[model samples]
Structures are given as C-alpha cells and as structure tokens.
Target chain A: MTETVSRCPVAHDQLPQPAPLPFVSEDPFHPPQRLGELRAEFPVSRLLYPGGEIGWLVTKYADVRALLADPVTFSSRNRQRANPIREMPEDFKEQPPKPGLFINEDPPDHGFYRKQLTGQFTVKRMKALEPRIEQIVADQLEYMAAKGPVADLVADFALPVPSLVICELLGVDYAERGSFQEWTATLLNLNSTAQQVRAAVDELDQFMLRLVKQKRAEPDDAMVSGLIEAQDGAERPLTDEEIAGIAFLLLIAGHETTANMLGLGTLTLLHHPEQLARLKADPSLVDTAVEELLRFNSIIRVGQLRVTTREVEIGGQLIPAGSSVVASNLAANRDPEKFDNPDELDITRGAVHHIAFGHGVHQCLGQQLARIEMRIGYRRLFERFPDLALAIPLADVKWRTDMAIYGLHELPVTW
Target chain B: MRVELERDRCCGAGMCVLYAPEVFDQDEEDGLVLLKIAEPPDSSLDAVRTAAGTCPNSVISIAG
Candidate 1:
C-alpha cells in the first residue's frame, strides 16, 4: 500500500477530495461490504463519519482479532472516550466514568476492576444462582405455555430472564421492572442523538442514585449491599461515585447484552427448524448449539474500543498512540481462514475458539453466568414446548437496524 | 479425550462442571477443572464439546 492508504480512514474525507467509500457500508455489522470495496480500491482508506468523528476501521479478521489480544500496544484507556471509528456521546464526553469500571480501563486499573467482579461470578457463586435461574426460565416458559397458541417469545420469555437475573444480582426491586427495563434498553443506544442519550443517562442516574441511598440505609445482602460492606472492610473502600459507576455498568451491561442474545438466538434457531429439531431430539446438543449460535451471529458486532498507547503495527498497518481501534468479534468469529467452514452453522462443531464473549485482560467478566442462563434457557424451552415455532414468516421479522448489536425487537411465535 | 486448561487465564467460574458433569470434574480448593479422562471419552464427546465450548476461559482442550 501507499502512504495515504496506511493513515486513518477518516482523514481522507476532507472537502473537495473526491473519493468513494468503497469499503464502507452505511449500515452497522455488515462492514464487510464496504471493506470489500476498500480492499479492492483503497485498502488503507480513511473514514470521517458524517457526524464529524473519524477513525480507522480494521477490515480484515487478521487485523481486528490480533489487535484485541495485544492490549499493551492497543491501549484500552484511549478507547474510554473515543472508539476511533464511532462518535462518543456528549454525556460520555462531558463526564468520564469513575476509574474502576472494568469496561473502561487499562492494565493495573483494569485488573483492579475485574478482580472485584471476578470474585462474584466464581463457580460457587454461579452454581448457587443456577437453581434460581432455572426456576426463572421454567416459570416464564410455563406462563407462556398456559397462555398458549401464540405469544411474543421475546417479551414473554427472553427479556425477563436477564432482567430478573440482573435485578437479583444487584438487589434491585423486581416490581419496578417497567422503568428498569426502559432504562436498560435506552442506555445501549448506538444511533440516538446527544440530547436523547443524555436524557436516558440522566434517568438511569436518578434510578441508581435512589437505589444507592436505599442500600446505605438498609445494608442488606446483595451485590450493591455487598460492595458497601466490602468497601468498609477494605483498606480503601470505593467512593460513593465509584460504586455508582460500577452498578451502572453492570446493571446495563449484564441485562441487555444477555437478553438480546436470548431473543435473537432463539429466533435464529426457530428459523433453522432442522437445527432446532436436532437439538430438541437430543437435549445434549443445547450447550454446543448455544456456542455456535453465539459465534454464528454474535449479538454484539464490535467489542469494546481500544486506544493506542504507543505506535503499533497490526495486520500490516501502523496505529499511532491516541488512535482508536476496535475488535470486530463478528468478523473474527466468521474468519474463513480460521474455521473449516466459517459461514455454515454447526451445533456439533466441537470446541470453536471464538471471541464472541471476547478475549484478553478485559474479556467478559459475566460470560460464565451468561452461558449457564443460555444453557438452561434452550433446554427447558425446547423440552417444554417441542412444537413452538415462529408465528411470522422469517423474512418479515423485524431486525433492529440502528444499534451495533443486531437483535430482534419482537419474536412472535406459536405452538 | 485429553482435557486442557489454560491455567494462566482460568478464573474458576465452574461453568464447565455445571453444564456438563460427565466431562468436567473440578478440584475442590482452587476450583480448576479436572478431566474424568486423560483424553475426552468418545462416548461423552458431545457433552464434553459443549462443556469446552461454553468455557469462558477457552481453556478446555479435548483430544482423543
């Protein structure tokens, strides 16, 4: 490649510069279409999104995956505010999150934040929650079976499991699921305006503020309450702001990501009835199938952003310090070079090395819990109503387009 | 099948054991995975593959 091809994609979008975004797609997730154009024409093209943000989008799997594992060269801190390729919301730009949330830190800081969460999701702790999670899955399916014939699988079953689990985890009141659900959904917006995003953040902040106050007064036993106690016993307990940020990150991340996965995953299976039947006939396949579902169509397209601390050459390109870089888990999972047949979905494909849950120092802290929830979800769902299938035609299903996370907003199904 | 653990990264989440008991047996104190077989048993390949796939650490390696 040439010098211009190697610099950031956004730099090439200046005025009077007639250049086509051959490798760039206006839609999210399908960045490959644009990437194809880029590789063929400007392999190192710059990207200046219409919103004034600019960054390089590493197109090939060799580039994105290799960069995510090497955190030292591609720093995580710079990614906290600017995700290089995507624009940062005004709310995030105005106020940086307190330092301990694992999603937004690098190395030593990342280690500290992750350590606090790591202790909570231990085998012992997750096993303890299994009975409760299984019960939740059954209750939802049972309720649906009773109301039978037709129901939206997403609202009735998929959405509740994760929401309730997060509620139980953080000790939030389940009765307020209405408001909490809204808060969880809006916080994950990828295309909403600055004012709208801030509004959502503000409401969520108020909700958390009230819960933090209640935890202080009661000091009951929950993640929040436990944190309060841990803080006291520690040589240095986290500040009130720190705890709030931690709660905010977990509550939002924990619930929405899994909930979307459950909804979209079931839909993916229902569409492929042969696979669904194969799984139902042999319940043992649920666990292996779940992994394939996660990899084949990872709900979250892009992993969290990483900033460069030093000049780094990744996938044959130089990413300077302060430049934003993101790992495309969707791309990595689908790399034809790695998997034998990358596009085909196979439930019995054995152990696939997928970065769907992510990899490296900041790998998903709650992945174990998500896996358990998914396992129980599919097992009970198929075992209980073996005939359950989609009510609407596969082509007509409404796929949410605005967000980076590709998920179905509603899944109408009937037995 | 031989079960492998990327011990460096395993956080003892115990998910492998919870999902598929036939394959993954855990150590009592440190909570690491202890395979039932030196390599994955052919009969238990399905369950073992599932257990290995769900492992968050990507530590489980099954070899016959």
Candidate 2:
C-alpha cells in the first residue's frame, strides 16, 4: 500500500495524463501501432476512460491473461457499475439486468449458468453441427454464385449464415433475423446514442421474452427450448426472466461476434492474396487459418471490462482495488513475447494459444461453433469460387470501427 | 506418452480437443476434458504436448 501510494502521488490530477484506454485505429484490421510500443514500455499504464474516469490499461500478453484468469481479484461484476462509456442514462429508472447474464457474473453463479450450456458447445456437439453448417455455407455460396459477378459479402453471406444457424439452434424464427440483426448492430455500436441502444435492447428483450413464453408452452429441440425444459425439471426452476436473459445473450452473442469475424477474416485474407492462395491450395489449413484469423484480427478490440476487487500487482504496477481495468485482446494477441512475427498473418502458424476467444472461466461458449462456421465458411467460399476477389478496392471497404465488435460493415467481392 | 487430466479443474475452453482430438474428448454433460487414449502412439506425441500446453486451465499433463 505504501508503494502503491508513492507510485500514484496524491496530486494525480497534476501528473501527465496517460494515453486513453480505447485505442481507435483508422485501420480496423490492425490496432494502433502505439499499442505494441505501450505493451513493451508500460504494460500497466494509468489511463483515462471514455466516461471521464482513470483506470488501468493492461496491454501485455501475460498480464492480460493473469488478470482475466483471476476473477476473484478482478471482477466482471463492475462492468455494469463502472462502465467507461456508460450505456444507460443516469436517471433511467429500469432495474439493472439481473445477475443472470453469466458473462457479467463472478464465481459460483457464473459457473452455475455457464456449465448448463457447456455440454451443448462441446467439440463433439460442434462437430455434429459441422455438416449442417457446411450445408448452410454451401447454400450461401450457391446463392452468391447465382447473384454474383459482384456481391456485398457481409450482407449476402457473412451475416445471414450465422444468423440463420443461430436462429435454428435457438428456435427463433429465421424470418425475424433482419430486425434482430439491426437491433444487435445498434446495441453494439460504441457511437450509438444511449436512447438508440436502449430502444434496440428493449426490442430484443421483448422478442426474446415472447420466444421464452412460446418455449415454455411448447418446447422444441433448440437450445432455448432445452433450457426451458431443464428449468421445468429442476428442483428450483429458473424464472422466465432468467430464461429470457440467457436466450437474449445467446441470440446476440451467437451471431454478432462470428458475423464480424467472418467479414473481417475474409477481408484480411483478400488483403493477403498469397495467404489466400495458400489456403485455397490446401483446404486442410482451414482449422489453423481460422485460429490465425482470430488471433491476427482479435475482433473484440478493447477486450472485456473488469474492475479490481482487491489491490493487485500486475506487470510490476499496483492496480488499486475498485479501479476499472481493460485487458486489450488486440494487444495481447499481437504480443511479440507470445507469438513469433506477431504482426504477420500466416495461416499455417497454428496459434492455438492466442486469447482470441478469450481465456479463463468466461471464455466464449460458442467458440467451437464459431470455429466450425469459419472453417466451413472460408473453405466453401474459396472452393466454390476459385477466382474470388474483392469487387471494390480495399480502401473503399467500410470498417465497423464504431462497433464493439470490430469487422467490416460491407465487403464487396467479385468472382 | 501417457496423458493425464485433472477433470475438476477443467473449465472447458476446449483447446485440448481442438488441438489433439484423437487423444482427447469432452464430457457430454459438462464439457470437461476426457482422455480418449491414455497412452497415445509416437505419431500423436507432438499434438498431445500442444494440447497440454494450450489448455488454459493447465489440466492436462503428459509423461512417458
């Protein structure tokens, strides 16, 4: 504590302001070059958050992993309370989301809900889903071939494939995808107005609530239905609100993150034709390629928000208790200490250790599904159209820098 | 190589299965690591090592 006080002097305000936590890059495929330097120089730096608060910005690979793994010292529960960019209005009277969202919870509660869905996302389960996913990929490619010479890959393929798959898995109607996609887009956009975000969230919740009610009355083979059935059979059944919360999380997380990955991953491959050619020549590289793509892009730019629950020492710096901390996945994935030639994207690199899906207890549950989708999606897209290339110049492509999930807004491609 | 897993510590990140599917599987109930072959052949030793190293929970260990 004495050391911590000495390092962070009483006149903190008078000291030079540290670089802001969220590093906005003009190039969405690559994070700001300064982040690498920061990771090397100041792995744990005091920084200003968008909400006008100072917090710890952790950039090094080992440090980021350490903080993420120790949820006891750094709690995800602070995400709602100490969000740098507050999403809700100060006077908004709606009750905060119940502790049912597993990602936001800590310890026993997180494990309780997460374990319930773990079996559903196992490698075997995802492997079983691979064939159906392949058909979905094939169908999308077939449609693209029929409509092409030119197409916006994001809308025509990237977004819909996952949307449809998730819809089928969740038992949500595929026809409702357009509205939900819009809602998700708005809800995740960093630049979106609070009112716009709230409206989108309300719409999504209402739809999920209806679906939960429907599932309660009549269960089916989908994940949501399975959850409902589990709830009914349990000694202490989950409330409809809890069930709806789970469904809502799955619906958005199930599609949004993967959709962005597909769009951005394709764009990244297109930028490096040599890599694309190598992948096209050897389809078996799909698995490793997906891992590399995930690592190279590391789409969730700023990583997850956490607050130190107790005084923690990281990268030789003391992060005071209750301080907001951001572990940059973008930085960690590119850590020179972790990977060789970190900036270069080599599909054959086999970067299995990367923290793209994140690390520790709250790692992405849908990761296996996302990997299979990418594997099938990339393989089928390249296989079907051997001459696939971008329809528009790389400069013209719109990057979703304003969104929480980093990716291309529209990737126009031509065969 | 003989592979071992501390099932209780498994958080189901699935890196082991992804890297060395031939040597590992996950429980259908909770996604915990399940060793398919306790002593995999020489050909799979490299993959087994990768799986052990990549596991976030460090649940997997290997010894001859």
The CAPRI classification for model 1 reads as: incorrect
Per-candidate interface C-alpha RMSD?
A: 4.4, 1.2
TM-score of 2: 0.93
- Please identify model 1 stretches exceeding 4 Å from their true place: A1-46, A59-62, A83-86, A89-94, B1-64
lDDT of 2 at A401: 73
True contacts kept of each: 0.14, 0.48
What is the DockQ for all candidates, taken in turn? 0.19, 0.62
Across A1-415, the per-residue lDDT of candidate 2 in tens digits comes to 5765566422344434665755677566688877777788677777776556788788889988888888888887656554554444564424454535778888867777887788888988889998899889888988888998798898989998899899999999998888888899898888888798789988988888899899878889999888887775677677777778888888899998899989999989988999999999899999899999999999888677888888878876767788888888899999999999999999999898899988877888889899889999998888888888898877888888777888988988998
Superposed Cα deviation of residue A123, candidate 2 (Å):
0.4
lDDT (10s digit) by residue, model 1, range A1-415: 6573465343434312322222223542244454444443443334454345555555455565567667677777656465433466655765765545557776666666666666677555776799999989989998998886788888898888988998999998889889867765665555666576678877877787788888999987788888777776776677766777788878877877787888888877876778888998898988789888888776766545666787666555555666655566666676666666766778888534666776665667677788889889988987888887889887777776546566778888898
Query: Which residue window of length 10 is worst by lDDT in model 1 chain A?
Result: A15-24
| The best candidate in terms of lDDT | 2
Error of 2 at A90 (Å): 3.6
